[model samples]
Structures are given as structure tokens and as C-alpha cells.
Target chain A: MKTIEEINQKIKDGNAVVVTAAEMTRIVRETGAKEAAKEVDVVTTGTFGAMCSSGAFLNFGHSDPPIKMAHTYINGVEAYSGLAAVDAYLGATQPHRDPKIGIKYGGAHLLEDLVRGKEVELVAEAYGTDCYPLQNIHTHFKLEDLNQAIMINPRNSYQNYAAATNSSEETLYTYLGTLLPKMGNVTYSSAGELSPLLNDPYFKTMGLGTRIFLCGAQGYILGEGTQHNTEVERENGVPVGSAGTLMLKGDLKKMDPEYLRGATMPEYGPTLYVGAGVPIPILNEEIAQHTGISDQDIGCRIMDYGVPRRSRPAILETNYHQLRSGSVEIDGTKIQTSPMSSYRKALQVAEELKNWIEKGEFFLTRPVELIPSHGQTVKPLQIKRPSILVKDLKTKAIITATAQDNLSDVARLMVDNNINHLPVIDKEGKLMGIVTSWDIAQAVAKEVQELTHIMTKKVIVAMEDEPVEVIARRIDKYEISGVPIVDRDNLVKGMITAEDLSRLVCSRDDKRGESL
Target chain B: MKAWLNFSPEIVNKAVISNLMKNFDVSFNIMNANITPKGGKMLIEISGEEAQEGINYLENQGVHLTPVKRVVKKDNDKCVDCGACLSLCPVEAITIDEEWKVELDDQKCIGCGFCTSSCPTKAIKLAD
Candidate 1:
């Protein structure tokens, strides 16, 4: 047994032994974990992958005359300027105002350009105030111009992630990369055995104030990331899927452009690629054993991306060994497998951290407070609303005609009323049939004059009290544009078309700006 | 020489590839292919002394040929060796070398252009 201080002491005396997670695996295999722990003082792990929940907070120095900016944009991408003047948070996924360039260039790209020392345009708008008279300001600046630019990522370094595949007949463009149709390929995003969270599954060495390698700069773990959950199935002391996440923060000005990247997923959106590393001090034999976990022992679940839903179906479970082998079997068929995360970069990060430790340039800091390991799980969003029914929709008043009416008369009525569908009703106002403008065209071509000859008797109808979702599905299934609502006695009431349902959605969106 | 062969729907079911192999002394490797009953295209690399003769035979078979001078081109200066394009390559043409750098084999690339869109740095592009 040993302490972190003892390990630091050994490092000061130039006697501490440090190795990467990959090398540690071989050492633990050759000798046992107990013996390896007594020899090695630290094991460094790393990962580089797209972390969408990432952004940076920048305090652009106050302009001359001073402006309390309410709106801020960096290189056309808008940043949240809800804080004090000259301060804004630029999210990695935030798109540009112009949709044409938004997909290719996003906040992530701007962040990278800033770190690369490229000139960026800054535009701000503010309402005139007595304290700050300036209303508008347009200027250009670089990373050094900012008073403070800190990357406070909400989530980074997922413990483990699921592999994505498509089962449908069409290709799916997703954050998991392009999923080929019919499970043509599988893409998994994680450093697997080399990932930082995987090496310290229980979070014994990682928590608040824990020093880490963030985008080639020294940073610290803030707290638990959003959607972090420790209540998950585990095998060999490691979670099968994503279980733990860390919120990390670091000085953006000190970051290297090589480790900070901006990426665009086709048909999805822009995201940031973060390179992070965590060095685990082998204080005991148990810590040594955790770092020795190999790719064969780690399992990742396969998810079907074809299902466009929150909960996609689980295809199967496989290990990193099979994934790295280039293919895995899914339902008796061999499917090619790829990785969204960069294993090559992950190895580079681990080696860099290992070198930093061996050179005595980097030291481990005891966490100020440990992140909560229990009593944490994501809660599904609760939506409070009553189900909408067909009757609730603003349907058009029933337009009726008689089967005895001449075809020219029905055509004239349709042209005058600007209606396409007309319900043929009996003298008692009960619906008998339906006719569309297309029917009139066919009638004219056939030289038919009687409305009865052109009318469709087998009419698909809807009930007033039926749920709007049910009616929408029926309309899609029957390949119809509109349906007439009827009473129990088959009396025509009103008509609901695809347009009415769509209008309802638009109005609902206007009512709730950001709610789903 | 690497070339693309487009088979029309009328001759897609014919054994043109098999007859080309039997009649010519050239060897061929199929890098990528998307052929259906309706019609499709195939990218193949052909070599040997009779490679020119094989080209003539495919042209006579009513197959449209588009010589693949280049498929996807990579700018080494902009690439970060992050391996983002490694997994998306169906032909395994992109690989990480011992030094952890991404290596692209132009001869093996099928020119599907999947990696061009996924690259974070936009370092890869489809050849004009």
C-alpha cells in the first residue's frame, strides 16, 4: 500500500515508475496486479472523441465607450450573451445564422480558429443604456485579446458508449457517423480500454480539482456531467455501456489546436472533438488491477440507429477486440465495424501524459471533493398536456352536394368555393359518397355527366372524438389527403385535411418556443 | 490502371466480368461495387501486360468506363492523424501506422468519399 504523497515523493527523487494503460496491460499480464502495483506509480489513460456537450466562456474586453452587449456573434455563429457585458458562452454545437454556412462552420470551428491564432470577426448589439452608451460594436480579435477564455465543457470522456448500426433500407446520417442501410456498417465512439473513465471505473482518483490533460493543457475535473449515471450493469468492474461522465474546465488560451478540433456530421450538426487524459496514481493493488483491464474484457452494446426514436432497439453486445478486428456478426451476418473515436490519437495522448509524468513536469493533485458515485440517474422529461383529438382541430365546415347533381355543376361549385373534396349527401344530410377534383377530371375525360358515376361510394371517414394521432396515421396509411368527419347516423359534420393537422403543429410551436 | 465500370440495366445480368477474365490475361481487384438488377457501377483495379486489352473488351461489352485518375485526395498538411476516417473506409484503405499517423493508400481507395465528410479538419476532398 502507498499514498499519493509517497508517489509524488518518489517522483521528486526521480525514482517513480510510470507507464501507459497499454503498457500496464502487458505488465499485469506478465506479472500479477499486486506485484505491478508495487513497482509502477502511475498509469496514464486518454481519449479523443466528439463531445457535443462542450463550449467555451469568453470575456471579450470592453469596447471603447463600453457596450452592455445583449447579442454577441463570433464569425457569424451566435453566442449566449446573457451574462454581464463583454461576456458570452459559445457552444460547440451552435450553428451560424446563415444556414448555408452553418453546417460546415459552427462554434466548434470558431473555437479552433481562435486557438490557432486566426483573426475572427466579433459583432455585438445592445440597447442603449445610461451606464453604457454604445449600442453596436463590430471588431476583430484573436485569442490573446480576450481577458479570460475558459472551456467549461458540460460533459466529456464517457466511460463507454454503444456502437451504432442501421437496419432500415435507407442510410441514416447521425452523430454516430453515417450508418449504411441494412446494417452495412457499424461505428462505435470510445477509446475503449484506453479511455480515462474506463481505467478508473469507480472514480477513486477522478473528481473535483483532479488535474487532467485537457486539449494538451492542464485542467481539472469540475463535477458530474449532465446525464451522468452510475446505476448501470457492470462486468469485470466496468460498465457495459455509458455510465459515468465528467464535467471538465480548462483555460482555452493554453490549449493546442491539434488536440481541439471542430467536426461536422453529415445531416446531423457540428460538434467538438476533445482530447483528454487522466493519470491514475496506483495507490494500491486494486487500482493497479482496474488499469489492467484489456479490450477483450470490455463490452459495448450495439444500437440500431435506423429507429428514429429516443430509445432505439439494442442489436447485440460485443467487445472491443471484435470491433477492432474490422467486423462483427449481427443476426448471423458479418458487418464491418468502425470507430468514431480516434484510437491513434488516444494512444498519442496517453503517451504524451506518460512522458510528462516521467519527465517530472506533471504532478497528480488529490481531488478537492469526490464526485457522487451513487443516487444519480437521468430522469425522463415530463410533458404536461392533454391529448389532442380530431374535434379539437379547426376543421372546415362541411361542403355538400347531391349525387343527382350534374358533373358540371359539381365542378363549378368546387371552382367557386376553392374546395377540392365535396361530400355527396342525401336529402336528410347523411353522407352518401365523396368526390374530388381528380374525379371531375376523370369524369370529363370519360364524357360522364352524372355525379353518381364519378363519386366514390367507399369513403374513408373519421370520427370527431378520435385522437388526432390516430387520424394522422390513418391518412398516411390510406395515402389520402383529407377525410370527412361524420356523426353516428353518418351525417356529415366537417372535413379534416393534412393541412389542418400541419397548421396545428406550427401554432403549437409558436406557443412553445423551445419545448419539445 | 484503376477504372470504374457502369453496367446498364440491359446488360447487368450478363457475365461480362467473367468473360473478361477468361478472354484476357489481366488480373483485377474489385475495390468497391454497387450493382443491382436495375443497374449499377463497379470500381476495379486491373493490372498486367494485357490490361489494355481488358479495357477494350469491357468497352465493347457496352460498359461505360470512367477512368479513376483519383478518388479522394488527402492534404497531409491539414490532417491531424486523428483516425476519424479510419473506420468509415469500407475498403480499409485508411490505416494508422506504427507512429500513430493516418496513412491513406490511394491504390486501395474505392472513392466512396465517406471519409471526406467525416473529417474534422476537412482535410480530405473528392478529386475534381
Candidate 2:
């Protein structure tokens, strides 16, 4: 086992440590919110699907939180419209002569066709021939069209009607099982009476599961019988109904089973998860009520606080995968509530979740024991132990320049040791000042010019035991490139440079033979 | 044989201009195109060149120019006595109330993007 001093030295020596997403998540979960917040430099959210249950283990701190909800929109009308447009384009082109040409659709239908080799392709020319006059249409045909095919159009209006009705009813399932139950309590009413033929048992028989949960919050209920609009124009006049209906009715959850099968499971079983959309409104309201601040102000504050914290090194390394995925594990299970699969989405979710947690709508808790995806490997580089403590690298060094110790001697010492700087020590071994090649060059330049130049009379020295980050920050902030490291006893140990700090984080991928 | 007209000035000028336009998007009216007698040879002259001129032109001009610079401006009508710029000014040159709008101390200004990027209405310009 290495001593703490040895470990510190190893870290100082620029040794790379490999950490797994699972291990990071576990640490965060164990540390709780405050500790995790401190441990985490950043948090990310909106890690849809399989990644939802894994984020809480990034770090012990809640530096970044997840925000953003993932939901699927099902739009049959849009699908039909898209199919109609494709058919129209194909009919006009009719590039392929082969009648047996294959036509493909979205992933859901692709999987279905993969199982059943026969698939349907609706042609607009045929529809036009059957429903409208062909002479009025000047059909421009292009050869070798890939999207053309032949199939019976399943224009069963009753099927669409049944689906539309069933969707509205099934929405209660999503609302009750997913959203309402999470919100705690709420009242619900529908203008369309519940079908007597449809009961809990009927739904169960249909594999819809039991609707055991209800919204806990107190809220008003409104329901009205409304005409179904196949097309409705907005103020912009682009027709909003199709897009709206598609978004509200599209079924993504049912289509992603194959993806789910490919998903890597967590160490523990299933757990509850919340979506960003569901929690954000509540969080915003709570924050507004609690702090008496405007929502915009709250948003700006959260964004300002969240981005910087997340940018920290430790937090970034900890929540790499969670930042990739927006969802977090609640209890032990992964619950994906977002549709996004991008890193930016995950970050957005994390920021929103941080705001929500701050507002106290829901408390973040430990969920699972994260297992390491990547095994640990020992780093090879070795770092020399510091002899003196230093607070910052920006300060000027105190050196005692003796008559015997001329510029040549200092230059020789620096060149021989491959060092740029050397702090001159007194007879008692106490640091008096420092010297560098640049200092010698300046002195030489002044001597050559025969100009009276005042050398630096005041000297600044750094304490040796300061954190490397602090030293680096001061060096960068003050535009100083190098500084002397000193101990609590004011003895000069070694010098650090901006180059060293840069090299510490820099890594070259040996396998790829490229720097990352 | 006249050695003075050995090189076609038009071809050279066109080639140089084409090359310059390829690398940079520049907007400038050609102020003058003149021929000067140097060492008994005709030399082409092109002027009124902005920052985005092509490589050959810039090389011939021999002036170091940054293509991108921050934009700064002050609208006196929108000036409120909010002392936000005083503390937020990285160079500590911006004062409140005396001029109302942001005042730049040329010596102190380091041409950093902080003040220009942070300004809500974009009243600061790091002029090229």
C-alpha cells in the first residue's frame, strides 16, 4: 500500500487514473446530495433509455443535476401523410420497372418486415387513378427510383377511429402510471364516459396492466367533447393539427423493445424514475414561491451556477456516461424518461434537475451500487516529492545573489540540471531570491546597452504545500508561466511551470497513436 | 524585345485577387489600381484593402491584421445609471454616471472578449 505522501506525489507526477461510470455513480449515490454535489464538478441529465438508471453514481456531490423529460409522440395521421407523399413522389418518378421492389418504413415497421418478408407500399398514382382523373395531372416520371413498390393500401377508417379512441383512453394509463403518480395527487375527469365494457380486468386481459396509482396533488379537472380535426390551421397558417396530433399520439415506448434488449442492466433491479418536464414546472413554482424571485432570474442563476461547477475535472470524469444519458437511477432501477440520446440533451437535463433539487420539489437519493465498467490500471509516471510548501506560483521568488554567484554560474546550474529557474539560498539555507535565463538575459542586455536599469528589488515567494490547482489558477490568472515551490520552512524544493499543469491532464491514446 | 512588359500585369492581378477571395470573405471597393516605375520596371498597385484580403495582397501589404475583432458601441439613449459595468469591467476602466455609456481606457483595455461578449445590447467593439 502506498503512503498518502506517495499517492500525492504520484498524482503530482501526472499519473492517469482510469475510473468507470458505475464506480463514479456508486460514489455519488453513497455521498448523498451535498457530498455528491461537492464531489461532482458537473451533473448531466436526459440520458434516455438504458442510461437513465445509471447517472446518480457519478460523484458524491450534486454539482450538476438532470433536467429534461423524455416522452414519445405517436402520430398515425402523419405517418399516413408521409406514406401518401412518398407514394406521390414515387408514382411521379416510377423510376424502377420491377414491380417486386421493396419499400421500407421507420424502425418499428422495419423490424416487423424483417420478421415477415412481405410488406406493403402504398402508391399515389394508383390512388389518383382510382380516386381522381389522370389527364389533369402531368406526371413527370424518373427512372431507377429506389422508393417505389406495390402493395394494398390498408385504408381501414374504422381501424384509425378505434386507434384514436383507444389512444385517448390509454393516455390515462401514461398519465396515471407515469406522470400523475409521480406528482403525488391530482383529480381527473373525462367528458367521454368510461366504457362499461372496459374495466380493470379488460385492460389487464389486453396486457395494459393495472392502473393502481393516482396523482396525489390537488388540482382542477376539466373535460370536454371535442371534434377531431384531421387538419387545423394555426395563426401562422401552416396547419398545426397534424404535427400536434403526431406528437401527442406517437408510440415510441412500444417500438424500442429491441433497443431495450440490447441495454446493459444495472447491478440492482428496476426502480422509479422521473422526467424533466414533470418536475421542472413544480420546481420552478416552488422556487418562485420560496425565494420570491422571477422564473427568468431563477433560470439565469441556475445556469450560471450549474455550468461552471460541471466544468470541473473530477465531476466530468465521474459522470461521463450520465452526461451522455439524461436519466438517473432511482432506487436501483434505470427509468428512462427522455427521448434524447445526445450529450447536450443530457447536460440540459442535469442542469434542470439541479434547479429542481434546489427548489425542493423532490430530494435526490442513492439508488444503486454501480459496478465498474472499466477495470483499474496503475499509472507509470513518477513525481518527485516537494521539499517546500508553496501557496501560489505567481509570486516572485526571494533569492540572495552573491558576488561569487554570477550570471554564468546561475546559467550553468540551470543548463546542467535542465531547469529554467533556480532560487538563490542564503548561508543558512533560507530562500533569499530567484534567478532565471530571462533574468540573466535582461542583465546582459542592460550591460551591453550601457543603460542604467533597476533590477527587481522586491521578491515574492510561494508556500510549497498549496494545492496544485490553486498554484495553477494563480499562475494563469497573473500571466506567470513559472514559480518556485517552497515548504512551510521556506526552503526551496523545485519549480513548476504552466507546461507541467498542461501535461498533467494531457493524454495520448497509445492504441490510436494520437493525442486526446 | 521590351523586357518591361514581359509579365502580364492583368493576369498576375487576377490570379492574386482570385487567390485572396478564396480564403477570405472581404467587402471593399478597389480604390486604385496604378502602375509605378520602380527600378525602370512597372509595378502594380492595389489599395483600400480591408482585413479580409487574400494572402498575396496581405503579403504584399506586409501589415499584420487580425481578421476577427470584437465590436463595441455605446447608445446614449439606452444608458441607465446602473453601475454593472464598473465592477464587471475586467480592466476596471469603466466608470458609472460621468459619461453614462461605457468608457474605454485604451491603455488598460487588453482586448479580451469579456466586456464585449458580456454586454447585453452589444455596446462594445474590439475594432479591427
Candidate 3:
């Protein structure tokens, strides 16, 4: 087995054979992993996709009179300025303060403009201080004008990510790109086999301080990225969905605008499209095997965005081979597929990295510490506040009726309580059915005297401990205005009307308004 | 020539399109259509020897025709070849080439403007 030092010596001697991940796939397929490992010195991998967790740290040199800037804005988007004066962190997804400009232009756009060497307006605000008296500073600057502009992305290069599909009636505008209605199309954001993390599945050659191609500039892996999970299920040594991620840091001044672009998806805010590549030194046969994995071997889950929840239901499991083929079958319908990530740019990144290695301008580095292969998992945010339940609703007393009761009497009871619906109950207070004002009017028109003839036999209901959100969904789904809260024995505990639920919402909103 | 034909409520369900093809010696291609039994509009390109005769016949049937040229324009400089507009294109007018560059086929585009909105950079737009 060869070491990184041996690979570095080969590069310096101009004898190192560096092949792209795509080329390495063919080499290993023909010459086996062991032979390929001996033949290839390094396997360069690349991926270009919209990485939202990317940002830049800029030190816009201190203004005249040395203003202690507490608030800073680049272009129209606000940047985090909680640090020292003149320093701010501009996140890619941060939107402009103006609602009209929200998502259309953002920090990503400003970053792109900076890389393109375009002039951007810088605005800072602060309270007048003794040491730094200037309260406000408005200026213009270019990339070269900044004292230090560093790209420190908390997450980039996901190993694999879920493919998106919309199963709803209306089109969904999401960060995954536009998902057309009724599974109209599927969109996935990954370079698949050419992706950096997929080629080095277990983070073998990649870790803290590992050198990488970050948006046309040399960068280092800071550590495990935020939400980097290694506990995901794997197939053919690659994680099925989004698993491993890398925290990357690079000099923004050295980045190329072509490799770093700003994209504003309709309705979804702006995100930075990053071109990144990692060179995997083929030190052993295992590394070669991992690099040799093809698009067909890599699998990802197809998630339905129609669910409108954090854990969207998986429609099916699909591989990049099926996805890249322009169409995939979901629920027996042939659907057109599109890649949100750019494969062409990804290939360019790979080719560029290969050239760098061959020209001996870039070298492989051993990781100071390996990224954790286990114990890391995605943990959802948990709030300690109590959720509103149907039982918790201080609903009005549940009015009841029996089959023997006269329809006019029940109608009178509804009129007296100013209620539209009344739950029909049995002798033991168990709910039998329900009747609404419309049913009473129908009974009058049909000349029906008995409540049995007018009352509905099937009643939609909610459980006592069920979350109010669930009951609200049922009310919306069934086109009803209310539901009877029932126990396990079908005993009517209370009634939750649309009015009651709306009041609850207003109260919660009032509390929020107070805090605001 | 490319022309948009508007069918009124009275003539919407009539066999005007079929009759035009059967009676005329001209060749026509239906580029786009949004029709119901009540009324609708259709974009079609008509050509061949009796094209003028077919236009006269359509006019006689109270069909309003508006000559259409290019419907959509794509600014190549602003496009990133991201393929966001590929799947949303109903007519398959937009495609990713072997190099993954986005290619727009004007001949196939019905000017639906589906790709215009999906483009993040606003690179593609419908002609006014």
C-alpha cells in the first residue's frame, strides 16, 4: 500500500497518475480494484450543487473614525455582525430585509457579485461610542477592497440526498427546486457518482485539514459538518440518502464566479451553488473500490413533499441511474426527472482538479483527525412547550339529542344554544350520530317529524388526547365546521367547532404578539 | 406561417379543424392548444400550396387569427444550464445536452412560458 507521502513525492517528480472519479470507475471495472489501486495515484471527485449552508466571513476594513459597526448589510441582505467591529458573516440563504426583495436577491447574490469583481454597496449602523464615534457608514467595495474574505461553509458535499416529488394538486416551490403537481416531475440535487463524499464513503482519505477544490479555490475540511450523520442505511458501501457531509473553508478571494453562482429559486430563497472536488489518493484497494462505485450502485430515497411535514413519506427508493435516464416510474406513472445539480459543472470541477494534481500545483494531505464514522445522527429540534390537544380545548358543553326526540325540539335546542350542529347520543351518552342546521331544514322540507330520519348515522369525530392540528386537518378534509371529541367507548366528551379552534389560534398569536 | 386561432363558444365543438385538414390541400401543425367545449385558443403553423385558401376558410368560420412569430427568447449568458426548466417544459422544448448545457428548441416551443418562471436567473422569458 502507498502512503500520502509517496503520492506527494510522485506528484513532485511529475510521475503521479491522477484520474477523475469517472475515469477511475472505468479503470477499476476493467483492471479490478487492486490493480486499479496500483495503477492510479489519485482519484479526483467533484460535485456542483446548491449548498445552502455556505457563507463567507468578511472583514470590511474599519471605516473612517473607526465606527464600531453593530449592524451591517451587504447589498440589501443583512449579515451577522455580532462579532468584532468591521467583521460580518454573510450566509448564502439570508434574505433581504425588504419583503418585496426577499428570496429574489440575497447574500448569495452579493457573494456572486463579489466574486465577479462587481461593486457592491456596504451599509453599517451602530450607536455612537466613545472609542469609535462614527454611528453610520455607507460605502462601496469590491472583492479586492476587503481586508479578508474567507468562505467558511458549515456544510457542503452531501454523500447522497433525497429526490423530490410533488404528489399534491398544486405545484410546490421548495428549496429542492419547483416540484410540479401530481408527481409531474422529480428533481434531485446531487452529482451522484461524481460527488466527493460518495467516492470516499467512510471519509477514509477525507477528514480535518484534508485539501479540496472549493469553488475553484483550494480549501480544507474543517470537521464534521452540521447535521452530518453516519447512521443512515447503506447499499454497496454508499449511504442511501443524505448522510455524510463536510465543513469546508476556503479563501473567497481565490474563488471563481463560474464555480460559485447565486441561484434564486422561485418562492424559495437564494442559495449558493458550490463547485467542490476532493482527490482520493488510491493508497489501498479499499479506497479504489469506493471510488469505483458508479451511479447505478448509488441509491437515494424519493420523498413526497406533499405531506408538508419534516419527515416526508418516501414514495420509493431510486438510484441515480434511473434518475439520470430522464424518467422514473412512481406509482406506475412514468415521470420525467431533472437534476437540480449541474453534472456538466461537476465534470468541469473534476477535470480542473485533475489538471491541478497533474501539474503538481495541488497535493494530497493526510487528515489530522478522521471524521467519526459512527455515533453521529440527525436530531430534530425539540421544544419543551406543551402542544394543544382536543381535551385541552375549553369547548362549550356538548349538546345532545336522541332518535326519539322531535326534530323541531332538536332544532329549537340548536337555535337556543346558537349552534349549528348537535351530536345525537344513546341512553348511556354514547354518540350515535350528528345533525346540523341544514339537516333540520331538510327535515322540514321533507316533512320528516322524527330525529332518526334527519340525523346522520356516520359522525366524524376526534379523540380526547389528539392534537388540535389533527382535528383541524380532519375538519378541512371532510369539509366540516366542527367535530365531537369522543372517548374510546364512543362517549361524547365535548365538541370542538371551527370557531373554538380559531379562537385558540388567536390566543396563541396574541401571546406571540406580546413577546414580539 | 405561425398563427394563433381563437375558437368562439358557438364553433368550439364544431369539426372545423378536421374539416380544414380534409378539405384543404395545405399541411398544418398544431403547436399548442387550450380548449374546452365552451371556447379556447390554439397555436398552429400552416404551410403548403393552399395555405391562403385554408386561412380564408378559417376566417369564414368566424375564427380569429393572430400571426405569431417567435414566442419565447432565452438569454444564453444568464442561463447556468441547471436543468430547472427541463422537466417543467411540457413540449420538451428545453433539454440538457450531452455536455449538460440547456438547449431550447424554438420550433417545439408553444410559448407556454413554463420554463420562464422556473429559471432562477430569469434567463428565459416570453416575448411580449
Q: Estimate each model's TM-score.
A: 0.77, 0.24, 0.81
Residues A1-516 of candidate 1: C-alpha lDDT, one tens digit per residue = 888899888878878899999899889988999999998999999998889999999999877799999999999999999999889999999988898897789998898999999999999999979988999999999999999999999999999988899987667789888888899889898888899988989988889988889999999999888889999999989999888999999999999987888888777888898999999999999999999999999998999987655677899989997887668998898877767777878888899998888888888889988877888897877547655877787776668899788888889999998888899999999998999999999999989888888888988888777777767877897898888898779899988888888888788888798664
Q: Report the Cα lDDT for residue A166, model 3.
A: 91
lDDT of 1 at A56: 94
Chain B vs. true chain B: TM-score per candidate: 0.76, 0.36, 0.75
**Candidate 3 whole-model C-alpha lDDT, 0 to 1:** 0.90
Model 1 spans with C-alpha error above 4 angstroms: A386-497, A503-516, B3-69, B80-92, B95-102
Clashes of 2: 74
Candidate 3 ranges with C-alpha deviation above 4 Å: A386-501, A506-516, B4-42, B47-49, B56-69
**Candidate 3 CAPRI classification by DockQ:** medium
Q: List interface RMSDs for the candidates, in order.
A: 2.4, 21.5, 1.0
* Among all candidates shown, the one with the greatest lDDT: 3
lDDT per residue (tens digit) for residues B68-122 in model 3 = 7777888877776778888898888888888889898877888777788888777
lDDT over C-alpha atoms for residue B35 of model 3: 88
